[model samples]
Target: MSARPTTEAERLRRCRQVFELAVRDRVSMAVARDRLARERWAEADARLSAKNNTALCGTAAPAFAETDEDGDARLQWWQR
Candidate 1:
């Protein structure tokens, strides 16, 4: 039979797997946060007067977009 992987190589592989899993988990958490923030913004907008609603929605949208981009980057890194 073929020889098994050396201990060092096995350890390195396990480490890589762990790192990838961490990245995935982090991305998931960021996405969830973004979702919750958007929900809150929507709720507040519904309750607020017209003038304040515009300002709150504008401030929250960029943060949501940035988190989405960050999550995408992390997913691409994990694939590598």
Candidate 2:
């Protein structure tokens, strides 16, 4: 049988996965921010509001938060 992954290898794999996901998320956020800057409020809001249910995959993280210029709390997709 093939050798199993070592603990260090598994940790590295998880870290890599997190980094890749963070990169993808940053790219997407940048695009949304650009569109928002262009006055595409609805689209930007929708994108930012989109919820990521990583819990389904068994990973739990803190929820995202956003506030409008008026200091009003924004609703996330999960909140909708």
Candidate 3:
């Protein structure tokens, strides 16, 4: 049987569980630090991905407007 991919939340939960286990078992400081680092990295990566997606799918604008007051207000290249 094939296995499904893990989601961000699941991975985070697993990382926390591992951290707790490490503390209980007196694992190396490096191991604990690594787990914490991985958790932080995952969070940062998720945030970056969300921001990029938002940028790509920007706010909607009028597509078939007869005239755009805002656009007209802006100075044209020739005017500049």
Which candidate leads in TM-score?
A: 3
* lDDT of predicted model 1: 0.62
Better of 2 and 3 by lDDT: 3
The TM-score, computed over Cα atoms with residue i paired to residue i, of candidate 1 is 0.28
Comparing 1 and 2 by TM-score, which wins? Answer: 1
lDDT of 3 by residue, 39-64 (tens): 87999788878743555457644468
Pairing residues by index, what is the TM-score of model 3? Answer: 0.36
lDDT of 2: 0.59
Runs with alpha carbons beyond 4 Å of true place in candidate 1: 1-27, 49-80
Ranking by lDDT: 3, 1, 2
Model 1 alpha-carbon miss at residue 9, Å:
44
Model 2 off-target regions past 4 Å? 1-6, 27-80
Q: What is the alpha-carbon RMSD of candidate 3 to the true structure?
A: 11.0
Q: Relative to the unseen true structure, what is the Cα RMSD of model 2?
A: 21.2
Sort the predicted structures by TM-score, highest score first: 3, 1, 2
lDDT of each: 0.62, 0.59, 0.73
Clashing pairs in 1: none
